[model samples]
Target: MKEFALIAELTRSLPKNDTVVVGSGDDCAVLDLGLPDQFVLFKTDAVVEGMHFLTECEPEKIGRKALARCLSDIAAMGGAASSALVTIALPKKFDVEFVKRIYTGLNEIAAAHGLAIVGGETTTNPERVLISISLLGLVDKKKCILRSGAKVNDAIFVSGELGGSLAGRHLEFEPRLAEARWLAQNFQIHSMIDLSDGLASDLRHILHASKVGADILASAIPISRAAKLQARAESSSKPPLLSALTDGEDFELLFTVNTKDAVPLLDGWKKEFPKTKLSCIGKIIAGHSLKLHDKGGVRELSAKGYEHFA
Candidate 1:
């Protein structure tokens, strides 16, 4: 089975409690935890050598990517990161300096985000290095965003450009933490998710949770220069538009808002994040299918984004 299929099966019978405000199927698991005004956001992510990074990659970048992945999930929930516990599994005979360099990168990013590296476990993995991060965050009860809040006619927006993450953005991209917080604080965001799994796949998460569909405009997609260049440089590479649709690890924010707020959000985003490019790529519809629109007109989008065990 594919990764999501297995996840659906496993999550079907998971244990839960009253404190579980949102569990499974979200960017982070939200818990009430008896907090009067805030909800606790919990997220865990892992990066494996060879799968997520190469052996030749810098240890610092590998460590940074490990933590940044979890931070992106926290940002997806529109929360502020608080602390983290890291677990690193390595071969029994590991280089001491390399391990320390990994922590150096992790610590630097953690400090920049005001997140403390509290504690964790170090284990042995016989073959490759694996770094797992469990992050904790807090969000205002009313301001928390979820994939399930999208509604019909809501306009979908994506932050920054998309595609060609393999070129290096995957290791160094900044989490859209501040951008997500600003959107939640300033606008009535209907729904939000970070684009880690590419727009094609991640948008489906919102649609599935919200019980809506989307009509994406191909021409409106903001393709990254890397994506365009890759297409031009390599005949075997996916076209720029397709890469923008399916290249995972963009780590940008994908969100929706009422159509009435679209103009205002764009205007506000420009003033708030002049360096970031926010594009209104689509709109939610009544059904449960994803469709793409271009000069050729509308058609069901059959292409899927990256998936494990596919």
Candidate 2:
């Protein structure tokens, strides 16, 4: 019942597709279109009750998040979401009104993002409620970003702020679709990922895939006000910046750009995206481990994101 074992058992191999360059086990799955002009991107994700949400949370929010989880994957790939499939397994005791509200929320968000609800299946589960979604998207082949393309000396960048999801931040998060599109159109982004897991765990996905290491400045992380407030109220100590480093479900984009192109690309992005905040917090290096630098000096980091059945 460990996390990896459960994933392997319930979600083994992906459908065989000649176009798939990389599938099923990365930040975003990639598909190659024969044409040099475009490629297809696909990703699937799930939300389970008692894990992703409180049992008492509004049903509408639950549905919105179910779809949001998948959309966030597309956003991470620098792709435009085209369609989605939704599947739900509800217990027999589920309420009719709750199901209706859930559909309402799902449809509303899907429409706003220009995604069509193409198909899905529903079944009864006696244990816990489960919502799973598969999303399809498109990106220019030349512009498609992968998790395996980072290089030494590249500047590491993260979109928007991080941390604080335990304080209701995860429920209201907006996927970085527009920002990702802007990045694709404007720069040669080397690698990218969405921060669904904590930064430490998720960053490992990018580094291990790219065969590169990174050193992040501890002070540069943007901790949300809500995270700080919660930490102080609960612990009677200074807020744990580690929460920003390891908290899951932030839904922000984490990406890298070559050092030579970083300045100009950032300048252009600033003029075009005044509201979305971007921060340069680290650099890709030639080793195999991630290091965090603070006034106290460098230290190894650990993956502290949410782990199921751990």
Candidate 3:
């Protein structure tokens, strides 16, 4: 069964409400709350021990990563983090101090992000560790952005470098909150998505939602330093470009701006975020497939990123 196809088939008939500003398909669901100018954003994400991390990973880092995952969802919608509820499932044989350390790390990050752990639940798992966080956020309706807003001829830009998440970058990555806020405030961003599943896979989410295609100039993508170093060390004959396309977990902002605003946004970006690298990788086209351009000429961009049930 084709994974994405199956997902589309199953969800095609799901019920929906008029109050749902943005529903299950996007990073976070935005719902009308009867507020004059705001919509509520809700998201839930989970990280498991074996899949997302090694069993020996520090409990504190795991806690931080769990919270960061949910916060990234908020960032995608250009919203403000409000509060969260965390549910933890611990192995039967775990130390109390170790658990406390996890909470301590999580609490610190929550406080820093202005999130309150209003409620949660705890349970025992057979031998694995699982942590899930459900977060609530607020976004001004007029200012909110979603994956379905892209238009043909829009310029595509991605914030920071991509790929090489396995080289400790996945655990230490910072969500692009400040960068997203700035983009929303200054630019007429049409669509946005966080790169959690690599550019090749995640870009399709935007294309499908927007009913548009993209033509990416492969030479323009900013591959990560870690990805380049890893390619050199492995000597596997694979290019760092492949990693940038499929490595996933980069958490950078992949957004589109009006073609007219692209020049100004890139120009002003240099002065405001001198440290961050922004690249114009592509343009949104009036179709529903992803195409990549290189010296070899143009071809379809494959969707090979992580998918659980593919």
- Tens-place lDDT per residue, model 1, 107-203, is 9999989999999999999999999999999999999999999999999999999998999999999999999999999999999999887888889
Worst-scoring 10-residue span by lDDT in model 2: 301-310
Show model 3 residue runs off by greater than 4 Å: 1-6, 15-18, 305-310
- Writing each residue's lDDT as its tens digit, candidate 2 over 1-310 gives 1775686676676477688787776656788867577788878888888999876888888888898878888888888899989999999898888888888889988988999999999999998889999888888887888888899999998877777786787777888888889888888899999998878878888998899899998888877777787688876643457778777899999999999988997788789888878888899999988988887777777685222211
Off by over 4 Å in 2: 1-17, 33-36, 236-238, 305-310
Query: Model 3, 149-243: lDDT tens per residue?
Result: 99999999999998898898887788888788888888889999999889999898899889999999888999999999999999774478888
**Candidate with better lDDT, 1 vs 3:** 1
The positional error of residue 133 in candidate 3, measured at the CA in angstroms, is 0.5
| TM-score to native of every candidate shown | 0.97, 0.91, 0.94
Candidate 1, which segments miss by more than 4 Å at Cα? 303-310
Note each model's CA RMSD in angstroms: 2.8, 3.7, 3.3
Clashing pairs in 3: none
